[model samples]
Target: MYALVDCNHFFVSCERLFRPDLRNHPVCVLSNNDGCVVSLSHEAKILGIKRGVPLFQIADIVKKNNIAIFSSNYLLYSGISERVMKIITDTAKNVDVYSIDEAFIDLRNYEKKELVPLMRLLAEKIKKWVGIPVSIGVAPTKTLAKVAAHYAKKYKGYKQVCCIDDEQKRVKALSTFDIADVWGIGRQFSKKLTSFGVNTAYDFTQKKEFWVQKHFTIMGVRAWKELQGIPTINTTEINRKQSICTSRSFGATVTDIESLKESIAHFTAMSAQKLRKQNSIANIISVFILTDRFSKQEEHYYHTRSMALPVGTNDTAELILYAHQLLTELYKRGKAYKKSGVILSGIVPNSSVQQNMFDNLKNREKRSLLNKVVDNINSKSGLNSVKYAAQISTDKKWTTKTSFKSPDYLTNINELFEVH
Candidate 1:
């Protein structure tokens, strides 16, 4: 059996972990630069604050309702996530950290009754020790465990741990859950499934494997089997990431070319770091810029340009130079830009890349050494200890607005609080 453990209102919950006073209070975590509502607590959701609602639009509502808002503090979240995963790993024989706030653990050895009490103890321990509340769902497969975890979070009687070990209970849970709420069934598939009268998890599971495979591909077939309590998804780690793109909305809309260039350079540097961390190199670099889609002016503009590298690389300087070239080509004088991003595609492990003989490439050894040195220095210090020229003196205006961000109590000594 697999057990999926998911933290409740992860980002908001991370904040509440330190400030227990925020428990049961309406709270939300905003996207970088405090752009919008990215994570909301149940109480905040109850007050009709929908995810992705712009910060400005909800300011009055949040103030009137006394909603606690926070800027995204990834440092705190990452440390807490590590602690949570450590707790899970120490408790379970086999565990996969699926996300920042979720993990799938193999629980085939435990009986239903034994698992329930153990899970309750586990949840309480994590809450008391790690300061994060998690809901665990136990079933024969990862997909079912995910559904079980969702039900556990939604229902109070489950005691934050729901086990679907019995055939009858599994079927009952599947029958009650909407098909769209299933882990793998997205909106378009849900609509198509609904058209075929497969509106619930039970209905989807009832469909023949042949029909599901024909319409939905291998993943759908696997999900269907999983819904029927047949384990198809493996708990083993999948190392390959399909794509990696880094983008951010500005703290405020930017119109100046210099500021836009700096933002693109900064994002490119970040993307390069990620690529290097994964030990991957991209063959193509894609740059995109756009004005606010909701602007009243009929001038809704977006441009994307993809450039093939002479040779694949994870070097920050080379990537930023190429990105700047693309930015210069795409940025028109009169255009008002709100957001920009860079996508590195055709990514392959650095070890797998075949170097070109004829192309006049930059010194690979020097670039790699410089990148490593820079990364080490930055990691020892903070971001921007070393940065590209384009990023220098660029107004901090391009940063995300995080005026209400909570402290990084775990990482930032200066931000730590002490109370008598």
Candidate 2:
């Protein structure tokens, strides 16, 4: 059996962990620059404040309903995620961290009768220890465990844990679960399957395997088999990401090329950090810029350009120089760019990279060591504690708007909770 343990309304829940008064009120966590609603409390959802709705569009509802709002405080979220993952690692023998708020646990060795109680205990322990509510769904496969997790979160009576350890329970759950929401089923497949009268996960599983293969190919067939309690998906850590891209919508429309360069440098530095984390080097670096799609006043511009490196690198300095070169070519005067990003691709393991005997890769060993030193310092201190000179210097010029962000209570010593 595999159990999918996921935090309930994670961002909002994280906010509520500090402000208990907001526990019963309508609340939401906005994306960068407070652009749109990315997460909300159940009360806000009940009030029909849809996810991804612009904060501006819901101002009336927020004002009338006394809704609490927050900016995306990634520092806080990341700290809390680390704590949650630690608790899970200590609880389960084998675990795959699925996302910031979810993990897949291998519960195969446990006796069938103990699955429910053990999972329930794990949920309670997380709530008590981490002060974050989680729902657990145990099943024979990762896909069904995902479905069970949905039920655990949706229904109150499940006591925050649900398990489909038997065939009957599997049928009952799959029958009511929407096909579109099933694991591995994307929006396109969901629409096509619905058109074929496959409205539920059980419906999809009922189709002939060859028929599913004909329409949606082998991947869809695997999803069908997974829904039927057969484990086709392997839960393993991804060794390397195909591409590393770091981009964010600006807090405000930026008109200056210098400020846009700062954003590019910062995002490139971030991509480099990720590349190092994955123990990989990138052979290609791409830079792109965008103007607000909805703005009628500004002419639209969206373009991306890429260049292959003579030698792949994960060094922040090397990546930033290329990023600046790309931005210089791509930036246009009088264009109020709303977003910019850096993408690094053609990645290979840093250890496997072959040194060019011909090309004088200036102090390659020194650059790699310097990156390690900076990463360690930043990790021990705060995010980007040691950063490239090209990145933004002043906190005031920070690209993303976090006007309503909560304190970094967990990560910062000064912000730690105090009692009177």
Candidate 3:
């Protein structure tokens, strides 16, 4: 059996953790630059506030309803997610982290009678310990477990845990589950399924296997089989991201090369930190800059440059130097650039990084050790505590707007929450 654990209203829950008064109120968390609604509380949803709607579009409603709003605080969210996942991992040793707020537990070894009770206890423990409510769903397959999770989160009658251990329960759940809400079935497939008069999970399962295989290929077949109480989806213990890109739109447009360089330098350093965290290195570095597409004051400009490194590296200094070089080639004077980013690709495991025959091995080892020490310090302190000189600039035009961001209570010592 597979049990899926999903955090309920994760971002809003994190915000409510420090601000207990937010409970029973309409609350929401905005996306980058306070662009759109990303997470919302139950009260906000009850008010018909949809996720991903532009904040400006709902300005009147927000003011009328007195909804509590917050800017995206990724640092705080990640810290709380780590604590929640840690408790889960400690309890369910065999676990697959599907996303920041979700994990799958393998229960093949446990007896059928113990499945629901075990996960119910886990849900209670997580709520009491982390102050974040979770929904756990158990079934014979991962896809089915996702369906059960939906019901567990939707109706409070389940007590935050649901299990589909028999054919009868599975059929009843699948009958009402929307095809679009099923795992692996995105909007595009849902539209196609609805066109064929297949509107529910059970309707999808009624399709012939050959027809599904012919239309959707292996991925669709996997979802189809998994929905029919067959375990076909394979979850690896560690899945390395294919590429990492760090970029952001500035709070205000930048025109100078120095300011853009500082932004790129900061982005490169962040990307390098992520690469080192995954024990991987990149062979390709790409830099891109853009002007405001909607700005009538200047011609829209978007250009990117990519270069192959002599050797794959996760060293921050090397990445920043290369990123700066790319930016120099791509930057056009007086463009009024609005955004910039650094991308690292062709990533490979650190152990598989082949050394150049004429490389300076000694210097490489020294740089590697330097990165480790710097990372150690930054991890103990806050990010960018030991940043390179290139990342520091007197001009702050490139910084993004975070007018409503909450405190970093878990990660930053200076921003710790105080109890009065």
Candidate 4:
């Protein structure tokens, strides 16, 4: 059996963790640059404030309904995520962290009768210790566990934990589960299934294997098998990405060369950090810039440039240097660019990278040590506390808007919650 533990209204819950007074109030968390609604409390959803609706569109409702709005604070979310994952790892020995807000725990060793009580206890423990509500769903497969999790969160009768340990339970759950919301079934498949009158998960599984093979392919078959209580998906650590890209739409468009270069430097540095985190190095760096997509054909501008490195490296300075060069080539004068990014590709494990015979080994080691120091300092002091000067802008016109951002309560010592 596999148990999937998912946080309930994660971002809103995180915001409420500090301000207990907001627990019963309407709240909505915005995406980067406070662009749109990404997470909402039940009260917010009850007000018909849909996800991804721009902040401007909901101004009237927010003012009238008194909805608490906030900008996304990734640092706080990630810190709390690490703490939550730690508690899970300590309790469930075999666990796969599915995402920041979810994890799958292997439960095959436990007796069937112990599943619900143990999961319920775990949920209560998390609430008691971390002050965050979680829903746990246990079943024969990850996909079924996901379905069980939805029920666990939806109905208060389950006490935040649901189990589909028997064939009867599995069938009932699949019969009611929306085919579109089933794990691995996207919109395209959902529309296709709907056209064929396959509205529920049980209906999808009833289709012939050859029909599934011809229409939905291997992935769809995998989901079909998973929904039927057959385990096909690996609940192991996810594979590392072959490439890392970091890009952001600016709060306002920038046209100057210096501001654009600063943005590119920031993105390249971030991509390099991710490469180091995964213990990988990149052999190629690519940079791209874009003007407003809605602009006139003659006004819009977009271009990309990539360069292959002589040797793979995760050094931030080296990557930024290359990215600046690429950006310089891609940038065009008089174009109001709204977004830009850096992509690090041709990745290989840092330990396995071939050393360039012409490269200075000592200097490479020095750069690596320097990066490690910076990373350690930033990790301790909060992100970008010790960043390169090139990442800082005087006017700060291209920076993300965080007007409603909350404090970094978990990550920063000074911002820790106060008690009287």
Candidate 4 C-alpha error for residue 46, in Å: 1.3
User: Of models 3 and 4, which has the larger lDDT?
Assistant: 3
Best by TM-score: 3
Off by over 4 Å in 3: 360-362
Residue 93 miss distance in model 4 (angstroms): 0.9
Per-residue C-alpha lDDT of model 4 across residues 1-420, encoded as one tens digit per residue: 999999999999999999999999999999988999999999998999999999999999999988999999988887777778888899987888878899999999999999999999889888998988999999999999999999999999999999998889988988998999999889999999999999999999899888888988678998988987889987442446788889998889898989998999999888998889778999999998999988775567888889999789999988888898888888788888889999999988898788778874458888899999999987777788899988997787777889999998866778888987
| Candidate 1 lDDT over residue span 1-420, tens digit each | 888889999999898887889898999998887778999999999899999998899888898999998999876787788899898899878888777798888877777668888888889989989879899998888999999999999999999999888889988998899999898788888999999988899988888888887899777888898888788876442434546799988878888888888888889998898788678899999999998889897488899998999898888888998998998889877766889999998888888777888757658888798999998876655556688887786266677777887776765668776787
Model 1, CA-based lDDT: 0.85
145-234: candidate 2 lDDT, tens digit per residue? 999999999998999988888899999999999998987899999999999999999899889888988999677888999998888887
RMSD of 1: 3.1
Q: Which candidate has the top score in lDDT?
A: 3
lDDT (CA) per prediction = 0.85, 0.89, 0.91, 0.89
**Which portions of model 2 show Cα errors greater than 4 Å?**
237-240, 296-298, 351-354, 362-366, 395-398
- Model 1: CA > 4 A from native: 32-35, 54-61, 107-121, 234-239, 294-298, 359-394
Reference-based TM-score of each model: 0.87, 0.93, 0.94, 0.92
Q: List the residue pairs that clash in candidate 2.
A: none
Candidate 1 displacement at residue 294 in angstroms: 4.1
Whole-model lDDT for model 2 versus the true structure? Answer: 0.89
